[model samples]
Target chain A: MANDTLQPALPTPESPASSVSTPQAGWVPMVLIGIALTFLALILYIPAINVFYQAFHKGIGPFLHNLQEPNFQRAVWMTLTLAAIAVPVNTIFGLCTAWSLANKHFRGRTLLLSIIDLPFAISPVVAGLMIMLLYGRQGWFGNWLLDRDIRIVFGLPAMVLATAFVSMPFVAREVIPVLEEEGTDQEQAAYTLGATPWQTFWRVTVPNIRWGLLYGILLTNARAMGEFGAVAVVSGNIIGKTQSLPLFVEEAYRNYDTEAACSAAVLLALLAIVTLILKEILERRTGGHLRKRH
Target chain B: MTATDHLPRTGTAPWQVFWHSLIHLPWTWRVMLGYLTLMLLLPTAALFTKSLSIGPAEFWRIATSPIALSAYDVTFTTSLIAALIDGVFGVLIAWVLVRYQFPFQKIIDASIDLPFALPTAVAGLTLATVYSENGWIGALLAPFGIKVAFTRLGVGVAMMFISLPFVVRTVQPVLMQMERETEEAAWSLGASSWLTFWRVLLPPLLPAILTGVALGFSRAVGEFGSTVIISSNTPFKDLIAPVLVFQRLEQYDYAGATVIGTVMLLISLLMLLVINFIQAWGRRYG
Candidate 1:
């Protein structure tokens, strides 16, 4: 089962008449690659390198000085806390959701699938607004919340909710396709062998999907940490209190605190870099089969 | 009587069967669906309700007002342009990554997702700096009397930054899995390389390309973080709908914000539906 080759949903028909051809060892392909790389450098690579250069251009003195500031520290702490609370909850939820969707054949399943992806398609600002409509002072449950003296909107909880909403599909999206392809043969065999559902899931299913699950968690953590728009509306951007790192970057940049903004941005970029590295490591270790599934 | 008793049930009541099935469902389904309903379903439902509450006339008025209309025009047009640019360049990059071997090729392949991994605010800040007149690339282009940052072009660039990975990632796998045998066959038949590509290679690739375009379009349309910083956000000039929605929320204009948010939401939903349809069609026919 572990060695089984799962066919992707869209099967490419092989034409027996012809063998696939490789590019000629000549100048044309080289020129094409060069041109493509130039565009990529302009659009993606240069801007990224510029970020690191600018952040450190003033030397480590100001960079270290900015990192030591209270607001910066608070923002980093807030961002980490948000990811801490959000990632685990969503990871567990994603696992359950993927398992159910992959194993069951109920009606409206496609709708459920689309709903999971709704966050990705929806604007983050709108995501914040939806929560406000439900939990804001004049929201649907506003009066009850006020009566209970509970705060959601303009608070940590609200920011976490928005972040969770934005990053919801990551884990499930990663795991679902793999689970679908893996099928239930081993699972059924486990059941026949008198293994309990939980046992089968732990011993059989989890092992198969762990790599995809880890990839999803990494992505979810990154997005949750970096989310700005949704959390911006919901968090009120109260410095030293509610501001996440991304919000700090925006506020700092708008206030013309380029040093602080760039410093904070560099931290986030490092996080992103770390994510990329880990992703690459995972891809290499897993033979990168899961990478293509997406 | 014996036959009747032994025969399988053919006409069970629908609701009764549904109830039985619901009861029989595992705890996993209940937990998953229940959680999704609370966290996702409820919030989305609230937006729909609030949007509808504004009365059709008011919703239409706000949705199509000149400012709203201009924001819509800027948002959709720039997103489309960005998506198209990404479509062409993205395919090129994917082709290179799959078809070539060069120094730092591994690094370049991995770095394609830098935009995805970076915080949008950071990306925005970085791109803004890089494209500003006094900045690196912008300094070179400044002599040409062309400005990138603080213009509609800047908005497009930001959108391009955020959406490029979508195009590349979607198309890369298909390209990797492509059977080169057919192109070889065409060549053996005395067909030119370009002709072989134009006819054989492109037909199968078109659907994936369109899928990538649609996905990139949706992402670019909804983009706000990078765009807000890079573009000047002047009304009817570079102000995008998402930023406008943020501006409204800041002004305590909940109703107005909800209306605009609803508009963005509906349009995005339509796009997503279209994408899903295209993907389904590709699956069936591609």
Candidate 2:
């Protein structure tokens, strides 16, 4: 609220003294900032340090041995397998949606764009519920699928579906803008040169949007691996079976295996760090290109 | 040139006609239609059908149950409080990142995105560990009569953490795009910093800031992963709507879960609509 009061004066530049005299420089603001930042630091640093410290307590031997546990290995594999399946599926879906939106005109274009952005607005936990409502035995489609003897929820398929549903928007959101900005000139040029649609897409369009697509896929991978709410609801947290890395950490923490939980968390954190680094690199490169053009 | 001059006057093949007609469809239209039909329409329809098929009486009974009502209160109030907190700091952080040259700028910038990168469950677990009674920060705060972990405050804190990046990232680009000359002009005119910021700079940034707030609020409302881990799923205390939905599903209360979920979805949709309206109004008048 104090900040809201200060917002109106944002355009003005005053002497340092006068500026400090404003409401934002009051003791209240200082105290608030201190509390906030202190809380932030506590929230960020403690568990992070705890995990790494726990990991390194007996050096790499025990830590490495922790990774050899059947549950840990299964979690790692499941996380990767989910990402592997979901990312590609979502990427293809995103690409097709982007390509369709980019290249054709029919009806309800704006409506469709909003729909493409839907998953971003919806809660992941709710998304999992939707999947269950549709695919669970009591679901509308669930009965139909059951007749075919197909089990979706409470298994790997459910995990994949939930991840893919939430991750679908990433690649499309990234690629659509690039395609919109770049226009269809390159594709048209390729078309005029006697290239087929597939060739033009691969040779011309993909090259132009590869960075965006990769960035999108990278984001998707990070989310898929880190995804908890949707997966947890559907995966049933069946130990090594449906347990993702995040779920493994949660289960371990719940089961009072503090050391194992922290170690698993550290593994997830490491993956997060790597993705963050990659995202930074890609963002910087994209920003540089945009700057050059401007 | 006449149409006849541009093209050979020959009968077109059926396949050629079909392909040309398909290709000639407006790109945006085709993709948009398909996307909406498949992604948005189908899933939402499924959800709604589930919600509505139980009829109004059953829906009301399920939705107004004590547990459901409590979850709603917790979800909305916490989300609102968290969003308000994050909005202020999010703007400050964005401004600092964009305008100030400071030590550890890159680190601070990256740190702002930690919530976005970290898994919500991990974030929740981390927060719980750090704020528990025997935890590092908890050890210090415990003497002060402030218990964080497994409280409403913990829910708010976890929600704030997970939703932080939305507001900051949303506001950052807008802040960066603002021309510096406006501030300089206000200063040259002898306006006080507060006056200039209030009269000139604040109006334009208001829309983006509000958008950020709405996004943060929505995210906090729907946040389940971190909140569940940190808050201990205590109903009527720290229980959020999404967690309630999960609990309902686990208990095989499909209709009840759907009713609660639909309420949340509707509320979020309303908020988003309001935000969009505010953004449009701001663009037109602010």
Candidate 3:
């Protein structure tokens, strides 16, 4: 962290070292910073605090009642189940992809890296449309599956796919940087000592990247649980059968169930705050290795 | 270090050859390629295939239709405005985070990423509530004849909320890693502070700022959850492309939805490429 004094003129962006001995910055920079911080406080801080405040403003009884509603309950369960399935799958996908990406030499490697981030760069709605194009009743594979009386679109499978797609990049994005920064020396050393690749990975690689991996998984779980647009498109927003927590929030808000919507939003906001806390801890513990990219 | 730095430095070493062969195995390739192809590559390909089936003429017709064009206009213009606003404030916020310590600093820093971690729909709901006519911020501005919740302004607010973290995160790291001695050296050389910043500091920061701008822009463009809830969703007004795609899907116009989606995909991919390029450039220079 820097002192309020913006001393010694503007520093080059992206340097990690802090300067406590630098001269204090002029009042001009202080005024600018004051305005910026104030605006930020109004925008990001106020509304977030308001979510929790309003959720409980009327009383915990209303919040509890909203929580007990079957629709809300089902949405919570569906959200958790989606995360349960999506996180592990994407985590594995991320591990394999990161392992190959960080360790391998092959053509189209850059292409693969970009592809991994495709989910992040693409709109979630577009992601859902892509899935629907694949699995809808008249879709390429959908027609074939229809022949066998299968239902993917407007179902749990579709929701899972949508969630998985949106969260695909998290673990790999986090792990790749750490692995790249840490290098492959230990893996190579393990191989020379007659360790199998899997053994070497479990023993050397995983431990080295444990914090980064957990951070990535934490982020993946957050996104998986909170994904809205893609799931909304593919799940058809069916109240009980397909509604995830986010969809439920949207529905509850639209239907003027302000209590229910605010409560649900508060729950998700709490999850997000928890995610941020854990991330901050991991980042400090790891000395911010998780923030690097190459 | 470049990604290729991790590659075996000497190609002739036995260990290096063995490692290459292992990574080159069908199993490794399958695990990497298979998952992506199934989850990402194939589905995206299917989307393009579906969209292309409508042919260029029909695709052009739908993409350029009056309503679609209006939706595109709303989406792009508001996103650009939001990204621009974020560009300025994001740098300010990042600077404050890097250059100043304040009370609740950790809490504020942690909360910056609330947008990233929080559900977008939840953001939309909360934002709509707070900015609606009778709501807190809305009520304050209601006397001024400013309507936010159901207009393009609300859409921009939603986009800004979700995309703010992008600029702050991108620029903050660069600012943190900045060498203070460069500015000190310039000051020692008798250069004015403003001149030193303009001549020395601004050059390297530009690429990073551009990268942040591009990322925020793309994120805003692709935004759906919040905008869908905040905007009126009426075409030729605040309606955005993503909502239009959703609306088309709801109407069972799968082809129309796919076409709109395809347009979004192409534009986003282009923007992402630009962002990645600028980031790489920043890494190289900054």
Candidate 4:
């Protein structure tokens, strides 16, 4: 009723702006857009372009050469392996957490959600420090691990754990709302029709939240592969062994290997872009919960 | 519903409540809790315990050491400046994106999250290169004697870069939800654009902008990858606290690292609470 008292201009999906904000002074919109564009061009677009420009500045031969370096290839493999290990773990955690959240209400549910979101708030450096505290040679489990000859705090185990710590919340954050929206009516119907819980979940619920799951997994994988600070603290940055791509970029740039650094940066930049584009598509496709701050 | 749902709740003892919830718990809940305990809770507990093991005096002395003090000053001051800049320009950008039609608007809108989706290490490398003394933007500022890269100013640039999207994303939703008629009414009553914005728009926008600034400030303060790369890492000059923590760790000062790390984490956690409060206020007032 109060809405009817207002202008009847309904916002369309294509141009929500124009409807809510009626025609302004022509210069107003133009100048606003121009200033925004100019700001983005300087801060965002220029940096993006400079990465590509510097990567190719020395010509494609050197660029290709940099990409072919043993350490560079090794870094790429490390990142993929890290993502493969971390994303699935977080995905399972997210799915189970979301399932528990949607299927029942429990005491301390809100507190649990807050705990899941802890990594998002904590500094990555601090997060790494936490892992070191728990697993470092001088740490709580240090002696036990020493006796067993298991190494952490500077190895693949530590790297995977750090990546997992940093990227764990994405899948849960993405899925919870989607699960809430999809509801349980279909699952209940399937159960009523003699389908087992697993069958109903696999056949009914999984399809319902596939887009959300994909979005979550996409974000988780990107974060897992690109993680830097925490992994840097724990990975020991041993070239060809522990350095992920992001760490490799920093090391290369610091060593004055501009071509190598930028080439590797180009790959990570592409991952970032791919993450962005796929994010856009998923967001549009599902009208997703990405808009909300998780 | 589980069996517990049908149970009478009046005057139930706490232990009984716990036992009821425990025995009837679904497999998913059990798995989820176990994972979280191993992954999130234990690490967090370890951090606090290790930091506290040295006692409060030691924690204080290490946390407030001269270098640590200077690092916090640099981190908070630069982050504040960056967040303030974000608040101003973020409002303008969100306004334009949600209030005006333009070519590539959707793309531009999505670009705001590039800082977020893009890895900070990548962002750090790019910002350092592009703002170096010989680079494009740095060259433009060179004549003004304004150095950006490898300085404290570069730290601010990085903070602003990474936290750029917070204010815009926060404000965009509120701006999109606004009624156009209110602005028209203000304008028809002889208010100028600035006057209307000051009187009508800024009121509702204040909470969101504050929330955004708080969020960005927390993010900037806790930032590691980019600021560590961009700044000179001088103890009293450009070095931020997270970098300082990393420095201490490299020197085998795990205790020093933990103390400083605890301080940084606590500051961010405080900021998180403040942001949530502002968001709650926004919901209430809006």
- Per candidate, the number of residue pairs that clash is 4, 14, 12, 0
* Tens digit per residue, CA lDDT, model 4, A23-63: 35447667877888888887799999999999998789988
Better of 1 and 3 by DockQ: 1
Question: How far off is residue A105 in model 1, in Å?
Answer: 2.6
**Candidate 4 to native Cα RMSD, angstroms:** 4.6
Once superposed on the true structure, which residue ranges of model 2 sit more than 4 Å away at CA? Answer: A1-40, A43-47, A103-107, A288-294, B1-40
- Give the number of colliding residue pairs in candidate 2: 14
Q: What is the C-alpha lDDT profile of model 3 across A49-126, one tens digit per residue? A: 779888999889999988899988999999999999999999988888788788666677787788788888899999
Q: Distance from true position, residue A55, model 2, in Å?
A: 3.6
lDDT string, candidate 2, A91-202, tens digits: 8778887887765454666666666776777888888888888788887688789889988899999999888877778888788778888899888899999999889988
TM-scores, one per candidate: 0.92, 0.87, 0.91, 0.93
Best model per TM-score: 4
| Candidate 3 local lDDT, residue B52 | 76
Ranking by TM-score: 4, 1, 3, 2
**Model 3 interface DockQ:** 0.45
CAPRI tier of model 1: acceptable
lDDT of 3 at B138: 90
Q: What ordering of candidates by lDDT runs from best to worst?
A: 1, 4, 3, 2
Question: What lDDT is obtained when candidate 3 is compared to the true structure?
Answer: 0.86
Error of 2 at A47 (Å): 4.6
Better of 3 and 4 by TM-score: 4
